[model samples]
Target: MGGNELPLQRIEPVSVSGRGLPRWLRRTSGPVALVLLWHILSVTGVLPSEVLAGPSTVLSSAATLIETGELQEAMWVSLSRALTGLAIGGSIGVTLAVIAGLFRLGEDLVDATMQMMRTVPNVALIPLLIIWFGIGEAPKIALIALGTAFPLYLNVYAGIRNVDQSLIEVGRTLGLSRLAMIVNVVLPGALPSALVGLRYSLGIAWLALVFGEQINATAGIGYLMANAREFFQTDVIVVCLVVYALLGLGVDFTVRTLEKVFLSWRPAFNGT
Candidate 1:
């Protein structure tokens, strides 16, 4: 008997039309609903304005802060510190990940130590950092750097190590030098993972900054929050929290956009 091939099943392409509201509205609906609910609750006295300020109260607080230039100054300080730490720590992470991933000796010497370091809570080092570097910008930046390093290192290392063996074989067969092979074959393949690390690291950087600034900050968002806490200014505190949320979301969006642009050659399901 002749061999028979099974028939392939038909698959329908995904559709967006009539599924829901327009994309922009769908994206924003959740937050809008939450805000409306919050306003309703606040109006009904289900939530106290002083204890847990509603969206309107928080918005008003933000406007007042902005008018006073307090929010703007605090934002600048916080952003500067975060960016500085990100640059330094991210550089170190990528460099070390590359070395450790590429060389057994480097892995043996560095990767274990970093793994141990990451296990320790970054905030625990704040006191030590203060003692060593004084209650200055140094400790804050250092804490942020520490927080920023580990995720990037782990992701980058994994990405490098996980590059397709067949691609490496192809590089060797083509008589590519070690440097050329890594640059052309390994790094490109590893970029997606590295970007993942970047997003995680950025998140941790903000968290670390929160702790770092709260410790002894003369000026920053954390300082503003601390001051608001002292007076029980729930509205101001909520404003700071909102700003942090927006900042984190902004950075994540930026990284995702960059990933899409750079990874155009790779076909993967990005939500349509």
Candidate 2:
């Protein structure tokens, strides 16, 4: 082969923009466009009415709901539940993860229970929780905490348990105290895994929110969707679903950004 023909050139791929927007539009791509196309076609009377109502009708319905401030109120209600539940659950989860990592007795006592709880659907707890707690924020928060706790405990426990014993021995040889060794070595070593637990726990928090808001809630996004269903307003349900999807994406983004910031010293593939 000639020198130039010895090897062909390779071109790096350039990602395309979708939905007349950036490629990062994520789940909004094909479905949103399809919905819009359906709406355009339907409103122009180009399609059979038996199939679906198009975008313009949905938009007008959405606009009407927004104008009455119901959407805003429902959004705020849902946001509040999600945020509060996250804070409470995440705090308990991380704390427990840390403690479980540090204490063998605690790990043994709680591991089995948490493993069992992990299998129990967070939503199933709603009925019992409503019965016991009367469908208040307390039960919802507890549910969120329950949903979030296990991953954190597992990661953190693994982090602490799997610490290099040699490192501890070196610290001992260096005459470092137990607390100092743990603080200086164990914590830093375990941080990446712990943060991963925290990140995954955020998704669980949202899942718990959906269930929590379903019981005795007159305000949350879930409640709005529930009420909308009675009126056969499919678009309103879609709006709530879109909000949840966006929120989850936003939270995952935040967690990843934090990982980049806090765990910068750890190599990419070096996770626990």
Q: Which residue pairs show backbone clashes in model 1? A: none
TM-scores for all candidates: the values are: 0.92, 0.76
Name the top TM-score candidate. 1
> Model 2 over residues 1-272: C-alpha lDDT tens digits?
55675566766534322335555575568877887787778878897444444566557767887899987887777777777767776677667666667878877777677677678877777778878888677787778777877777778778887888998888899999878998998988888888788777888878888888777777878888788778777767767887787888888899889889988887565312
- For model 2, which pairs clash? 39-54, 39-55
Every candidate's CA RMSD = 5.6, 6.2
Report the number of the highest-lDDT candidate.
1
Native-vs-model 1 lDDT? 0.92
Where in model 2 is the C-alpha error above 4 Å? Answer: 1-53, 269-272
Candidate 2 local lDDT, residue 71: 78
